[model samples]
Target: MITDNTGGLPRYCHPYHGGWDVATIALNIPESRILFICPVTCARNICLNAINGGYKDRVDVLALTEDDIVSGSYEEKTVAAACEILDTVQPRPKAMILYVSCIDAMLGNDHSFQTEEIMSCYPDVTCFVLKMCPITRFSGDLPLVALQHDMYAPLPEEPVPHTDTVGFIGSNIALHPDNELIRILQDAGYRPLHIQACDRYEDYLAIRSAKVNLCLMPFGKTAGELLAERYGAKMIPYFARPDFTSIRTTITAVCNALDIALPDLDAMEAETVRILQECAAYIGDTELVIDSTATLFPDILRKTLTACGFRIRRIYADGVQQKAPDIDAGSIQMPLVRSYEDNENVIAIGMAASSFAGADKTVNMFYDNGEWGHYALRMLAARIRAAYEHPRSAVQVRKEARK
Candidate 1:
């Protein structure tokens, strides 16, 4: 979580980086294989991530040599590597995610050509050309965003007959069974589909039959739009935020999109409030800390927790656009760097925060775990209380958060 004060390459900490990596996300497609074509230096860490992520069996590496790049033979080599995997790998993959590193981007490799060649050779296999290029991190379309879009791009463009099914895009973890959104849809006789819910490639392709596509995160918005345009479904993006007002707005939008009567949220809001108050009372004056590793918007989370009567002592994030001064009024905003002593009284919300503070009381929440609306608030409170009552070491918390 170190801030890059020097404009050079940013530093990466393994333990602090939670949630699924690009390899894991790519492999989410059923019966999929990842062929990462990059120089030896770049492939090492990605291969390690895939191995550590418990998906090494599905991932193969094609290490690029200096001659391959200099002689412009890397493109052909990449296709050959993918074809070799398709031929030799037992029970051929239904889908293949072909990855290229920053070097390929710099050399202007034509990925479309490679994709066409692969598909032409193996018509049964779906091939997606994905970039591992981190040089475009600040660009509008980062690798993760592109991956989300491409993963679903393989879905048929031809219209499928509409069904009561609704698709939820962009969450690595499936929404909780008791989540308000799931409950509402199920009660209304509509089936909800998420990538995590699919056991087979056919189950995933059924997303085209959905009348509406709900995007759970901002990164999945592009994929939702693609589904809507290609399959003629309504695209509804309710990027999850823990705050009550935001949750209400999301619920209203979803109801309007579905043309269903809005469910009363007052009771839900009250339950969330009650839970928060209980947790806060138990937590007392313990110093609470947050970090970006746990969530995309640490400042927004800080504001939500502060408004819920929990006094957040500090926030560790690389960069935060202070939305409001009052929410961050007394809380210290520090860079995501590990530079603190162990403190039993300090409760940390994220792995990075716990690692930095060395706090025993740590809540292991990563990327919100697909939680949203009032349900998210209640779950957060429950986690906070649990962390306080049964303190765990930062290492144990971090390990659980990653899984």
Candidate 2:
């Protein structure tokens, strides 16, 4: 019996990132009504979130269950259910999205055939299918998904545009609400042509037209490379970390690539310094110990947190690919089992359980909320502040206060 914790990776890891092999088909036709069919365990969360984010009217979601997996007739039933839902809804969807799960993959269910059958029955509705192959064994690797996006999205209609717009690529999972990159670009007087990760097919096809591309996360390297090859676009890679200097470096590189005059480094440096100073106040003298199934934000967090005066005692990161050389070596390496003493100062960062033998706090940093990467840093800073302001209750006494 294999027993691996399903909660290893942060839930906010974007669906578009290749951590799960999701297949997408774009119909030239605009989709008015849509349906999402997925495994029972994963469906409610994904569908509800999408609905909360304003896709409810056009979207209908249903989950497949264990019985369906056992019977192998679930696919047919799922299609029938979707059609029924469409009929009940009155206006049928122009496009349908069939989201298959790991069970479907294991059963070797032919989604294409299911789609064809559905099409023959309801010829008016355009149909599409996507597969979600969870990277439980491999964890989530965003670059792999970015490649898949490149492969699945239709080719551009015209030659790549030669505009000054830059392509911003990364898993939407990693983006903060403030959208730091967009702020920086706007501050620097440049307009971004494309900011991918959750963009529609048309936007993806327009990526080749950008004058250059800025890869904010490693997961975008594959897509960036593809666009460069096809459209002569140059790529500027940046990792997530809150260092003002790093941000400045990124901006400089981008400016150079676009032939835009460099922003005053002194001014940029001062602004970054101010942000770090404020961050330091929030993160003073606290110690953190993070463990993740993947090295999503460790490097950036380490650099930024260290600058802000926090002590990183240890990190247990897993599922690291050899390709991510930028990851810090001093941090705990990947594929590690629990081996720490769990001192009072330690606070964990990834999907690892909070109940490890000796840790003071097992904070869950990533989850399906699609805001893990952004929230983790802020949460870390807030925890540190709480600890300093109330040392006696800081260790474990003030759970409600922390919240």
Candidate 3:
């Protein structure tokens, strides 16, 4: 059953996609701490998420009350809070991310004042103003994209000479060193860089020396452009897709940008297809479900898996209608206010689908897990095969996944 868009307000958002939230992503910086200022109501969930992610020690909340917001004293309050944290916190964070939530967006608070005050008080600690404002989502950069951009906005561009470094942006989890992208750069005598691989603030700051920036996700394009404008690095924007054709196109685009010889696409595609066929054969007509959380482009994943003879039972995503005009499987908008029935035989691919289906067999993949090109497709096939061979509780799988 193909569902039509009944656009209005957002109904539900399932919690099974145990990938890192915005706060966790911001904490990716080495020795960095966050001071998230928002209404007390929002702090409950944010604090709990921080505690669960094992970064509670690095997170400080300044819960705003109605009086504090109405009086416009939140700014001063934030300054005091930041000063106290800076003065007492052991070893002192190298960078402080001053995060304000949606209410701050409505208040039209000037963050520069807070940032300036903090820096004045603690000259050694670098201050960055980050917003979690969803109200401005449609106007400028969405919160997540803005966060990605701000994460590296403070790196010094001047006096950092260009090197053989090729920066990979937008993936919280670094691509495996054995990935084809890394192999291509290595073969061309270049070093691949990802923020997740950085062990120190200085290592993360080394992105300023990259000659080229490959943005693996769309949100990273803004950050990539920043690097290009400031550091004169070439920004190549590509998305992670599981299909063979898209993978080839991404590789070709990257090679063209770098003026490097094209890789042997035929051999890579053949190997990936062989893996997919073997996995599909083993699964043997078992119903599979995909969710948007696994791949932003569920339509593409559906086509890729279906071509490999895997039976796609349904796709639960909100925005697949526009891309998938001729939908072949059940298409249900996520976060519906009803309960999902449990199924024993269904093998769910993507955390959202696993949670929604309550299926025993689940593939623990979220946003392709930073995989791109043929490597992504091959790994997906292998994970699916593994899930079939060794079934596990969907809930347990979600818990075990790294945020």
Query: How much is 160 displaced in model 3, in angstroms?
Result: 2.7
Of the two candidates 1 and 3, the one with more favorable lDDT, higher being better, is 3
Q: How close is every model to the real structure, measured as TM-score?
A: 0.89, 0.61, 0.91
| Tens-place lDDT digits, model 3, residues 127-195 | 988878767777688778998998989886584898988898987778988899889989998889886
In model 2, which runs have C-alpha deviations exceeding 4 angstroms? 1-39, 42-95, 113-127, 135-164, 173-180, 187-190, 193-208, 229-233, 241-248, 274-284, 291-295, 319-403
lDDT of 1 by residue, 1-403 (tens): 5333423444545454454677777777778888988887776766777777777888888988889889988888888999999999888888888877888777877788898899999999889877778776665586778889988887777899999988888877788989998999898888988867676888778899999998888889889889988999998888877678888888888778788788888988888788887888888888688877676667777777777788887776654534454433222233334455665578898777787778889987778866887778788888888888888877666566653
Return model 3's CA RMSD, one decimal.
Answer: 3.2
Residue 364 deviation, candidate 1, in Å?
2.3
CA RMSD per model (angstroms): 3.3, 7.4, 3.2
At residue 84, candidate 2 shows an lDDT of: 84
Model 1 clash pairs are none
TM-score of 3: 0.91
Measured on C-alpha atoms, candidate 3 has an lDDT of 0.81
Per-residue lDDT, model 3, residue 226, is 90
Full-model lDDT for every candidate: 0.78, 0.52, 0.81
Which scores better on TM-score, 2 or 3? 3
Task: Give the range of the ten consecutive residues with the poorest summed lDDT in model 2.
Answer: 16-25
Model 1 residue 144 lDDT score: 78
Spell out the clash pairs found in candidate 3: none
